[model samples]
Target: MSEDASLPLFPLRTVLVPGAALGLRVFEPRYLDMVRECGRRGTGFGISLILDGEESGTPATPAGVGTAAVIEDFDVGADGILALRVRGTRRFHVRRTRVRDNGLIVADVDWCADDPDVDLQPEHALLGVVLRKILERIDGGDQAFPEPHFDNAAWVGWRLAELLPLEQTDRQLLLQEDDPDERLAMLLRLVDIED
Candidate 1:
């Protein structure tokens, strides 16, 4: 195990899977510094979903599961805010996080490989179907969610968990599940409608 791996923390409500792209705006001073530091080091930042806090809002422990994101497309706004697109490269688990004097959070993380069975194609197809259905239902109420592209079973599961409007606990459950087939089944049957 590589023990020296460290990642700049950017906690949010979404999950960023490997090969997936995510856009973000940085206005907070701490995060701005984080971006600058990453640029200086030519490294990426860690993206973990905030369990019970908001960006620029509160300090809370982040979930252990997250992906390491590399800044691909970057721009600066007229008002001095930063914007960039980050592509997920790998999965990691947070050992712990510490807040800096500037309000940015940094964490020690370890790289983790997904279970071998997650690479199977059938799992991806099944998860893709369930995800499409979920999105269709959510879109029935509102019209802005973009159609997702899942390239594999692992990606399908990650993207669905990221895009779904479920609570943090549910998303965490999906992340912790090691079996792609079981996760797909749980997701497919996740409904509490009285009908």
Candidate 2:
């Protein structure tokens, strides 16, 4: 997150949580160019949930707090579409924003400290079980979630927050929260994962 204080901004429709995997289809010219630039520079871009406007044609308003996504894999299809796979690395707070002529937005953002890994206490064991079940159900098996961190409160909460079908606003709220235990509470109340 320190290589460049100013990372390219992408106001996306979905919120990217730290340690979560997300796949995006790049079709818009601005985004296509963004992928190329990020690839060439070997730098990641910022992803914020769009607060207003559309994903294309207009420079949508974005949430001030966002996640820095490091590109993991990419491919170009026969239709000239760029398929991007990314992993959220860290959370950031936007200091300023500006749009390019091509409608790309770049921002000066400060990286947020990662949540300290806290052992998942016994009270929250149900949450861990739910996350494990969801991960196991995905067709990719372990590939869907990679290495699971059932003992870490932050990792369990983030995985559930991403895998569950909760509203984007709720997920964005979880992303902005600084406390892993608090985030876990919110997810437990939202999904009622407890029996």
Candidate 3:
């Protein structure tokens, strides 16, 4: 992840957690241009959850923290639209934003530190099992976790956050959290409450 710098922001209605996969359709001209530029540069774009406004026509309010995403695949959809499959790589904090003449929002952001490599504690092991079962039930469930890291605390928590039916705001809070054990603890409470 780069240090403090500027990045192109794509504001959406949902939150994107690290180590997860998301699909997007590019019909907006501004975003289309961004996609072309990223592809040309072999670089990724930043995705922030829309805090206000819609996904088109104008610049929308975006969350302060978001995930950096890289395009994994793209194809023409049945409607002849460009469909993109992106994977979240890292988290970043938006220092500020600017709107280009074309209506694209670019943010000056600082990359968050990588999650510490903490082993999954025994108490949190059930979360991993639950994640596995949920993924098994969903179609293409393994797409978000191409390689499993069930023993890693942060990995399990992030995968669960992506797969769970938590509210977008709740997921955003999880993304903002800096401690993996704390995040996992919160997930445990959320899972219990959801149950």
Candidate 4:
């Protein structure tokens, strides 16, 4: 782990993985300011799953591992809330956190390495096929996702982990695993794909 750097933290109930897209409706004044600053600076904020507390009033306790979220699209909703589409760019491990006077949670975090590409093995063929089918269903007769790398083990694993109907804790565990192979193997087990 590298030395920690401070990042604005958004502790939500969901976990985000690198390359995944998340839509957020911003209503709170503190987060609205954070979003404005992030957009102005063209920088991302950190998203960590909330360990305790709610998203509305008080600052929540965030989990250790988190993902960096880059704003991809922004608009003002009819209700006058800020609606933003953000993509997960990278992973980080929170070292420590503190609450700012304005109620935004800032954290000192160490960035995690991106998953290395690995060639898909024959044993993992079923997992790849399942992932492709899921994407197709989500796309609804059109390819909404970018060109997929079913032949890449790391990509396949990340996509599967993202699309699977797994618990937040389970997804968080997969995100924290540093090894792509181990992550895929764990997914296989979670999906009850026996060797």
Ranking by lDDT: 3, 2, 4, 1
Best candidate (score: lDDT): 3
Clashes of each: 0, 0, 0, 0
TM-score of predicted model 3? 0.94
What is the TM-score of candidate 1?
0.73
Alpha carbon lDDT of each predicted model = 0.72, 0.88, 0.91, 0.87
Superposition error at 188 for model 2 (Å) = 0.9
How much does candidate 2 score in TM-score? 0.93
lDDT of 3 by residue, 1-195 (tens): 559978999999999999788999999999999999999999899999999999997799999999999999999989989999999998999998999999999999999999999999877878888988988998876774578888999999998899899999999999999999889989998889333
Give me the displacement of residue 132 in model 3, in angstroms. 2.3
lDDT for each residue of candidate 4 in 1-195, tens digit (9 for 90 to 100): 245677899999999898888999999988998998887887889999988999879999999999999999989989998899998888999988889899999998999877887888887888998997888788452444667788988888888888899999999999899988788888988999766
Clashes counted in candidate 1 amount to: 0
Ten-residue stretch with the least lDDT total in model 2: 1-10
Candidate 2 Cα errors over 4 Å, as ranges: none
lDDT of 1 by residue, 25-105 (tens): 998777888898999998999888887778775555678988789999998889777889998777788887888877777
TM-score of each: 0.73, 0.93, 0.94, 0.94
| Tens-digit per-residue lDDT, 98-179, candidate 2 | 8899989999888888799799988788999888888778899597767778999999988888889999999999999999
**Model 1, global lDDT:** 0.72
Residue range with the least summed lDDT across 10 consecutive positions in model 4: 139-148
- True-structure lDDT of candidate 3: 0.91
